[model samples]
Target chain A: MDKLLRDKKAIVIFVAPAFLLFTFVLFIPICQSVYYSFCNYDALTKPEFIGLGNYKQLFTIDRTMKIAFKNSMFFLIFSVVTQLIAGLILAALLTNIKKGRDFFKNVYYLPCVLSSAALGLLWMFIFTPKLGINQVLAQFGIKGPLWLMDTKGYIILPMWVIASVSLWQYVGQSMMLYMAQISGISSSLYEASYIDGCTKAKAFRYITLPLIRPMVATAMSLNAIGSLKFFDLIFNMTEGGPNHMTDVLATHLYQQGFKYFKYGYASAIGTVLLVLCLIVTFIINKFVKVDNYEM
Target chain B: MTDYIKADGWIDTFNGGEGAFSQQTYDGKIYAVPLNIAAACVFYNTEMFETAGITTMPTDWQGLLDACEKLQAAGYTPLTISAGTAWCLSMLAGYLCDSEGVDLAALDAGTASWLDSNVVNATNKMVEISKYFQETAAGDTNDVATANFYNEEAAMLIQGSWAIAQINGANPDFENKCGVFAFPGTDGRVIAKSDSLAMSATTKNPDAVIAFMKYFTDDTAQKYTAEVGGKIPVTTVEYDASKAPAQLAYVMDVFGSAKSTFGFYNESMASTEAGSTFDDAMVAIYLGTPVEEGLQTVEDFYKNNVWNK
Candidate 1:
């Protein structure tokens, strides 16, 4: 073991596969993107590099890119915060309840078990103005505007609705992570709190919440990562419609890369997405330091 | 999906009219039949009209509104669409542009601008249509119109006719009930969206393919489209409008008078972002957005994604 650890050649062999994978899967594509971002390269012809041209256009000239970027940021903030808060509340509720707890756990976890494709179709019926929940609302004499089909400004409210669906479908994993962390905290701490005549609220505020902080960070980080790549349910639902009002980066990448065959431009968008995700996750880690904590 | 040849001897005797280009080429060539055709028309519910005591089918824009009011007053939703498919909006946009006599091809090819006075005015026309019908649209569930039409929840739907197969695939006893008409926009010209089957570069059986095409376009296949499928066959064929099912006769007439056919213009023809940006602007306008700001967003996106870059 000592000999192997001391051998630089052995260490190099161990790190080589990961390094090569990072180069192939991440670095090389990003470098290609950085190069393409300067050019008006539409996949078919030879690329013409004009230096920072694409980036400059995206900022100064592109209206849709601004909307795309804003929509992505909206999802990132809303999905992460809502899912974390909702998950924590449900997880905390489950941790306290003594009866029918398993049933509640299964019920709340059901959306996670569903494939997004199936959920999207089912939700369509629910949101359909004629045949879905909107129709049901109509029976009670309530006329409803088109929900997903309405593309007028929401003043940020539609973002809330879309984010809620995202959070609903995903909170299970976060809730489970938080619950697992809460369970691992020493029971003796709860007993000691009671012996000291601390209220249940005080015990929960100080003991349960602080003990689960690391897990909260982990859940939130995962949620942020998820919100950034969101495509399927959004695709199946609005398809970035009411004229691409609900469009996101991943789906935009999909359309440009495959449907339109603008490979270079799509790659540039993908590279920007990767950098944004990395920066966000790094900032999160800096604040919480989840990896450094232990129960 | 099933790959049986339908018996070559039987195909030879049964009728070779429908395959057209495919019929002439395939046996001497590498491969075979059934190319795609795009179909869009105004499909309406006969049952709804009957229930509302309306005898004549709505043939123009005002006529469509009159029917919508009649149907809605009679306790039915006037129109239905599925925004989930999304391309429907662009189809609507295409039809709207065609109505205005603005060549969508020119628009797609960079010869025309989406924000041009004509195109913007056309878009305004569509927002007017959206408001007129108060169309009940949801996700990719336009086929819901088929049911709503049958069940009398909605009176009409504008959709691609390829969906005729999917709609009729259901075993509902709609009494051979639904019919189609050419798009009636701004009352100036009538048109339909046509789907085509482009020849792929890779073909091992070129002669067989040409033969199959010829066979498919023959009268036999054309009749199959009218009588069995209710789709408007491309090749000209003589048939009795009265002998056809009630729902299908209107389609033949509509197909007969089509001034010019268009395809899904925005997604198929525009640059990467133009169609998408235009699609969003349309939805915004439909939801009561100001045309000035909406067109500005489209113009900025158009400049960056197309002209400026």
Candidate 2:
């Protein structure tokens, strides 16, 4: 086995297939998107290089990019913080529950397992004014504002609504991860804290809290990235409508690429999204690097 | 060869597979057939009509409101709309305006505006419809609207002919209870949409598909579309008034004598926001935003943010 691992031919054979596949897929698309970023290729026309013009429009000329970026930032910061707390609380609750704990865990994780489209459809029905909660609210003499259709962007209603949806769909997943991380902490730490005359709350704060910090950071980072790239749910629920209140980077890119057929502009938006995600993930990974140092 | 297929939304007449053409031998004349279709007219329960005390399907503006009022009095919603998934509501809005002889095609191309008198009238009509739609039924979607009609709950549902197949395919039985009519406005003109067949350049069976198109466009096939398919024919094949929906027979005549047949509503126009994005304004309209604002939204979006920006 050692000799085979050291063999040059064996190495070549093993790496060749993966290398070819990567070159065909990963490298080509990145290269193509980069190349397309500077050109005007509308799928119908031959490409024409315009030299940073697409980026120029994305940064300065396009109003949508700014709105998308702003909305993304709001959700990224708000959802990560809010859902982390909500997930941890739920995880703690599940940990303490003496009855049907496994069943409750499965039920909590079910929404996260559903496709974004299915979640969005459910969200639509839940928030739709006439047939949904609003109708129920009417029985109590209340008329809720049209959640998805509201265009009065003064309050950022659409962003908050979409963020809440993302939270509902992803909090379960974060809860499960936090639960696992909490379980991994030795029970003896809690016992020691309690035996030393600390209360349950203090034991939880001193033991379970610090132990799951890495997991909380990881889950938050993952969910933040998820919101930044959120496309399908927003697309189906509102199609970025009511005067583009809920338009995001992904839907904007799709609109430019497929609907408007502005391929170069779309590529630039994609590159920006990729770079943003990478930068964000890198920053978050630094805080969680304590685990890597031990390994 | 003309490139289109049923999968692309033409009638499933012949060669209804991936290919575009079908064979035909009509009167010893051999030619390539074409796939084409149009929007349909619909009518609801006349009992609801009578409860509204509407004696006839309204032919003009006055009769239209009288019908609506009567339908309301009879405890049924008058209009059937499904604007969320489909742009039939927009089509109806456009149709009402076009019946007055406004050139909506030009308007769609940005040569006109919602500020135009005809457009304003259409907007007013929509506003009226929204306001008059029983508050209970105003915001409900199309399927519910159809269910309400079929279950004898509502008086009418204004939908395209393709919906006939869907209604017939359902568990609820209408069975000669529902009827259809031309949407009345503009003093007798009809607003309609047509679907067509065009062959792709990439197909290997172009000749065979063309042969299929020929068969599909023949008189016999045209009749199949008219009678069985619940769609009117592109060619001048006459329908037997005695056999089919009386409104359809008259529709065939009206289709023949139509001053103009608008292509599928703005949403069906390729590369336009009228379908995917701009057309989504229906939700906004239901939420109490004005129609002119909706039109202005698309127009401003086209001007400020789209290509050439």
Candidate 3:
């Protein structure tokens, strides 16, 4: 094994399959999208080279593009902040509980495993004004605001509703990561802190949180990328409707590419989404400050 | 392939007569067989109409508005439409545009703008009637909106003939109470579309494909198209009117008496993008964008995207 690790040829042989697979499957398509973003390709005709035209239209004249960008940014910020706080609290609570820790974890994680498309439909029914939530609200003589239909503001009500749903479905993932990291910590540290007159909250703040920094970075990057590319939930819920008030970048790209057959423009949107995901991940990694804790 | 199918002779045999093959023709050559024709019109609840004391069917826009007023006064939601499904709202906009005589040819030719008086009036008319839509109109899917009509929660639904199957299927009891009429003030012009089948240019078995295509227009299938599917058969065929869903008979009468027929504006636009942009613009209007600003979105789309292309 030591000889194999030292050999350059053995290293190439071991790594070549995954390297080649990544180049063909991921790298090539990304390059093609970048290329298509600069052309006039409609998926039916041969691409005509029209440099910067699609990007210009997307940035300047496309009104829905602005809405999509704003909505995506909203989702990214909302998901990161809420998931971190909620997941950490849940993790801390579950760890300290004397009973029902596993039960609580499983219940929260159940939504994460279920299909987002089905969840989207279920939530759509629940939020529809004449039906689910509003129906219940009416019995108390309260008129529920159109939960998914009101499009009166810059960031509309439906976007907030979708963000909350997404948070509900995905916060479990971050919680589990934090729990794993928290459980790996030495219990002796808690005993030592208790002897030193440190409260459980202070111990959590000083010891558990620092030990979990690496996991937090991992969980947050996952969340940032996931929320930036959010599609299925919004697509199945509102289909970016009430006049595209809820369109994120992915939904806009889908409508342009598949529905409208504007492949070139859609590719431009896809490229922008890709850049956003990368920049967000970079920012999250930088801010979270993951370090190798000698625990 | 169109070259392999020998469509001209077969198309001539269609019972719908000369114009039956018109939609399938390209450069004087027929390439596909249409299974059924569909038209968009208003389907109303007769019982609800009677309850509202709407003695006369609306013949014009004012009468339609009056009918809505009476329905509202009688404590019924007058209309149910799916603004969530953009195409459904756009179809309604198409009828209004048809009634306003917004010239598609002139728009394409750059002789007319989408903000022209005719287009603006059509949008204004749409906004006026939209008030009668159910409270959840902006978020209801087509299925939900259709369910609203079949469940008798709303007095009327403006939908394509294809909804007949869904409506009857969801509530068989709705059949007895449903009535149909062409969109008011359109002078009987109906927005129509057809389900068409075309042979693949590379298919190896042309004879087999042709045999399958012929079956759609044959007497047995054409009759089923009307009696079972509740759609207008592309080929003329007679079936027992009593056996068909009651709404089918009303739809047939409207289709038969139409003074003119036009395609859905969203489906017939220069490109799918322009059509959807048009849909988005219509929805913006529905969601309370000023009519001029909403229509301006489409006009700008046409100038920047469609015309330049």
Candidate 4:
């Protein structure tokens, strides 16, 4: 078995299918997007080589690009911070409670399993000014500010509303990851810590958190990538409306590529998004400080 | 191998005559046959109008505003428009532009700017009229807006002739209550769209395709267009109005009386991108962007992206 593992032919045979699939499906398309970012292709016309034009326009003159970039950054920061803190708290609470743990876990994780498109539509109704939440607010003599339509301010009210809804839907996944990591830590360590007069909080800080650093890195990276590419919920809710205020990078890319047929400009946006995801993931991995703990 | 159908000889037989070929013609030749045409108009609830004490329909810009004021005074929502769907707001802007006589051709040719006085006035007028829209107009979908009108929550909806079918389908009882009129201030001009038929230029069986195309504009089909589909047939074939939906009579009257007709501003733009940008600009105005600023964005888009192309 050892000799077979080291065989070059065996390695090649094992890696060939995955490598080929990756090349055709992911690598090739990414390369094409990078190439297209520098060209003027409208799907119907032959691509014209235009060096730095799309990028120049995106950075310098495009107001929508600025809005999209700011919104994406907001979503990324909002998602990562909230998911980490909320996930840790939920994981700690659920782990200590032996009774009805599964039931509580299922309740928290339910939204993560539901379709975002369906959830977005449901939330749209809830947030509509003349409907759901606003109607309840009206009953209290409180005129609710348009939750989904308010376009005032830089970040805008709708962006915050959407970000909160996204957090509600996704925090469960983060909680589940942290819970799995917590449950994997030996109960003997907690027993020893408690015997030494350590509080539950101290045990969580020294034993549980330090041991789960690797998982935290993984979860943060997952979350960073997910938030940067966030599209479906926002698209279903706003389609980047109230005059493009809620547009993140993905929806803006969609508008440029599919709605407007500016494939080259859209590719430029896509390239920016890809680069952003990579940089964020790298930062998360580097900062997370995962030390191998021998349990 | 590449020869488009020339329907110029038979074009005059259509309801709008040669004018119906406005969309189907290219380079001094006709390429397709229009089967049915539809126009956008104002559909109001007759009961709501009577309750609002509007003795007569508005005929011009000021009168329309006055009518809206009356409707609001009577505790009725004056208008229900879909700003959430950009095209619906853009359609309203299109009518305003038409009323102001903003030359679409001139704008396309770069001879006129979107910020021109007429265009600016048109946009301002749109903002002025938007005050009477339903409370959630900015977030309401087209379906919701239509529901507002048919449900009697709103007194007016600016939609196309195609809405006749949707309105009737949603509430058959709304058949008699709904009445149609041309958009005020356009002097009876309407924004029109049509479904046309064209044979493949390279088809081996041209005769077969032609036979199929003719069937669309034939008496039976044309009659069905009005009676069942609640659309305006392009051909001059007569149909029984009594057999058609009651709202059809009002729409037919407006269509018949239209002094002129033009295509949707969005559809008639240089590119779909330009059209969508126009939609965004209109929606921006609806969302309280200054009229000059919103129109400037559209002008900037035309100058940078469209005119150069």
lDDT of each: 0.68, 0.68, 0.89, 0.90
Task: Report the lDDT of model 4 for residue B7.
Answer: 42
CAPRI level of candidate 4: medium
Interface RMSD of 2: 4.1
The TM-score of candidate 1's chain A against the true chain A comes to 0.88
DockQ of each: 0.50, 0.31, 0.66, 0.62
Across residues A1-295, which tens digit of lDDT does each residue of candidate 3 receive?
A: 9988999998999999999999999999999999999999989899988999999999999988999999999999999999999999999999999799899999999999999999999999999876799989999999888788787888899999999999999999999999999999989989999999999999999999989999988988999899989999999988887777899999999999998788999999999999998898888888888778777
Interface RMSD of the candidates, in order = 3.2, 4.1, 1.5, 1.5
Q: How many residue pairs clash per model?
A: 49, 25, 0, 0
lDDT for each residue of candidate 4 in A172-281, tens digit (9 for 90 to 100): 99999999999999999999999999999899999999999998999999999999999999998998987788999999999999988889999999999999999999
Residue lDDT tens for model 1, A66-89: 667788988999888888888888
lDDT of 4 at A219: 91
Residue B151 alpha-carbon offset, candidate 2, angstroms: 3.0
Regions more than 4 Å wrong, model 2 = A1-23, A56-71, A122-162, A283-295, B2-36, B40-42, B99-118, B134-141, B171-175, B236-247, B253-257, B267-270, B274-278, B281-283, B290-292, B304-309
Better of 1 and 4 by DockQ: 4
User: How well is each residue in B219-289 modelled by candidate 2, as lDDT tens digits?
Assistant: 78777777766676665566564654444554556556655445445644334754544455544565567
- Clashes in candidate 3: how many? 0
